[model samples]
Target: MSILSGILITLIFLGIFISPIIGIIAGPKIQWNNQMKDSCEYFDTRISMGTHFPESQYNIRSLDQSVHDQTFFLAPVFAPQADITAKYQYYHRFSGNTANTAHLAIDVDLENAIWRMMELDGPDERTKWAAVGRKRDNAALPAFENVNQTVIYNGTIEQLGPHLWIPDFMMLIQGIDDARQHCEIEPFIRVFDVQGAPIEYYESLIQPKWNWSPEWDEYLMMRTASFGLGRQRLDMCVRENNFRTFEFEEDKYKGVSDISFVPLAIIASYRMRFSEIGRLDCSKDIMDKARDMI
Candidate 1:
């Protein structure tokens, strides 16, 4: 090849390599930020969809229909967003046959389950579990779409029978007590766009009928971390006779919740501000016009 032709090719290759650097230098002067429309407008569009919101009459049912030994409920305090919903389930001892004492546990969606699975299994060991699922149906679980009328969170809580009592606090369960006694659980309600990005986040506090166990503190913390909640070990903690164990591992308590139902008070408290999580149109472009000194 001629020297000039070879030199031209070399310069072309060099320019390609340096173009990214040049763009980086020039990027600061160019405003690439896309402008989005008002978030409230998006919420307004979603509200126009006309879906049923949470009402005072919360529904509680059994995750396990066969036995129905234990009952659970994920009663929404207010109207949730179309995409995002807040669910709360606890163990109910007043349901079915206690002869077998079988606990029915609910599971989170596959995606969240995989995350917890990875957390428990070290990074190195996760690959094996991922490969374990062979069937297509058992493969990657589908993302939660428009679950119009289904409760998502499925953790259980057990009310300590009026037997055990500690002077320091309203001690119902031994070996597993936390400061959550009579604590107001204010769950942050987040609404996500079609792209799975959260567009709006608000708070709604559920008034506790009874003090929750310390075991649930972590569960509550994790549930509040996302607009979409997941399932955990929905077990029960009961006050057997005069003594109470940290947590009851019996099968009957699985998916069992024991939160008391107070219709009027719960409805009143929830109506304070967030009565309904309005929907929004995430299609518009909004921009931040702030000047950064840096």
Candidate 2:
């Protein structure tokens, strides 16, 4: 063949081989870049930090006095309501003479995590895992529709266990909803020093890491059966990974406690609308329990 003919043949082969590979890689890269841009805009504009953090936001003296005063001072008491769902309607109807102590029940929903393990696409800076897919993404993130309220907790982090560091000091939180019978609650922590500078921020949507016991599943099944809901339908809702129960280990961080005032922020779906539904008086018994929990 002539030199031109040979060169033309080589070019044709390269196009056939390289074009497909380029198309395959480029398609996802372009799509992911667009998705990331959408995600960033969504988070920045829609999500609220809940509390206004001023320049002296971290300063102890300069902190919001109202928030500081309420922290660890008042117990979150769910007010009486007759309009609630049938599941918890009994709790209100039967409590004529009983102390409103049932309000102290802490049903924290930690399974609905707002952040996820993100694998970024190199060159494109797009996420390898799309947050769109419910199962395929493998990581869950908070979205505008999913989040309703924003709460901030100011407190100090103390060593709970060898590897567990939890906020153990004065805690301030806002936008807590007692109305919802079932909702996701996410808590964010902002630790500040005496100098009014932030130390660290921790936020997570927690799911129960432990496997559900057969006994637990059985109990749930029995409860749903009473409601006339089919067992199969309830089974679909009761995913083992969806729920977790949390309780503070009083024995763990008992004393020699280093107190630091930090802020805990949360965005939840329920609103603490107690205007119409009067708040229960913070009785000595209730206040004592609330203090102990903190």
Candidate 3:
């Protein structure tokens, strides 16, 4: 072939051979770039933070004092109706008191305060693993084996029915009280997040279901809180680079002797009321009301 003809033919062949490869290679890169850009924009337009808890030393005494004062006034708010027979009967089953039933009005102000601190610290920076530490020898059955084989086997089978009868009830009551108190204090936390645009919201995806009695109820309540807070914090981390991801550390709170002050995880999912680009205004009324309630 003539020089020009050969050159033209070669150019044509090169274009045909290389074009598909170029397209294949560039396709994923282009898509990835677009996704990265979109993600960056999504996070940039919204405020988010990693999981974190307040680093300040938590004062249990102060929290207790606050609870004492608040409960003193609020106790009357939940005052038993003139006829508390029904209420008494309901709790009597749990409390095991037929006469002069014990009234349990759990105060959750401490829980709220702890949660607020957690929110302020953000989820990204907080530790994930809860250190349960060493619990008292509270196990009902001593770690002893019966000499009689039949009796040992029967005892094992019988004990399988329910493990947490009383503790579960206590935890359920505590969780309910905690949730109510959290609702009361939510407004304050909103103010704390005012500077940043609201983080991208996600509906709570985790739910607790109860199949057993007290244990089921207690587990559901605790799981609800943990999953709810975890979802919220995860979304925040995804939306805004401010919050840290959760990393569970084993046995960190293991030595803690105070059962009441044991560390607990919080999880919740929320949706942004407005688009990321939308304007946000803090509500003074809400803030004021929350402060007053506190």
Candidate 4:
């Protein structure tokens, strides 16, 4: 064969070899980029933060001075009927008395999520891990929409039956709902449709506060969550990995002791809303878990 003919033949063979390899590396890179974009846009907006920092914001001070704790408060509570769902109306928002104490419930559609777990997609940014699948834990949910097929078909959860995703904090929320049903006078309760993200991009969406800890200041979060102006410190969940060293394990700096401030924020807000309901103890288990954390 002539020199030009051999060169041409080699070029053709190389193209065939390299094409699939390029695809193999590029495919995940492309998906990763898309996920980053989605997570970025989702967190940057008020969708995630509005669960606490509302948009149509009526002052928590409410133009009422008897209520304290408003110095540096950033996570002001959204009024019960405000347009919290301005971006998506799939949810039903309403508030009324369960017996005498104020009771607020916002039943989320269970089909949308802030991160979406790469499962369902839509306009709402709720913690809608329900309807994703129906496990015995979630039989109360509506018919299975199979919103998230990835987890159900994956053998690990197959035997557990179709499982739904409920955040750890909802245990407290649900327990509060029960306490309101039977207890005497209790602080008002609001079941937020919100998931755990913030107004800024974080490394993990699944974690409380999306694991946004910038330093080893969980103690700061605990102290701040109870104070009006201090609640902004509650914006972090688990301590950053860099803080998870010998000191953290030995309790020098504290580990996940404050498992999450999400619960504390809920409880503290209840105390604020009902100034008389001091030491709000609706859910014993949850309150115990959050006692020191709050």
lDDT of candidate 4 over 62-94, digit per residue (tens): 112232311111122123335655522342221
TM-score of candidate 3 against the unseen true structure: 0.17
Residue-level lDDT of model 2, residues 229-284, one tens digit each, is 11111100111111111222222221111111112111111111121122312122
lDDT of each: 0.23, 0.22, 0.21, 0.26
Where's the lowest-lDDT run of ten residues in candidate 4?
151-160
Decoy 4 TM-score against native:
0.19
Q: What is the TM-score of each candidate against the true structure?
A: 0.19, 0.16, 0.17, 0.19
Model 4 residue pairs with clashes: 135-162
Model 2 vs. true fold: TM: 0.16
Residues 1-294 of candidate 3 have per-residue lDDT tens digits of: 599999999999999999889778776655434433322222221112222221111111111122211100011012255675423221100000001111211112221121111111111111111111112355243333222111100000001121111121122212222222343222112101111223331011111221211112111212211113112221111111122112211222211111111112111211111111121122234545556999
Pick the winner on TM-score between candidates 1 and 3.
Answer: 1
Q: Give the count of colliding residue pairs in each prediction.
A: 23, 21, 30, 1
lDDT of 4: 0.26
Q: Which candidate do you rate higher for TM-score, 2 or 4?
A: 4
Q: How much RMSD separates candidate 3 from the native structure?
A: 23.4
- Ranking, TM-score, top scorer first: 1, 4, 3, 2
Q: Per-residue lDDT tens digits of candidate 1, residues 71-169?
A: 222222222345553332211111111212222112222112110000111121112222232234657643333211222223322323311112121
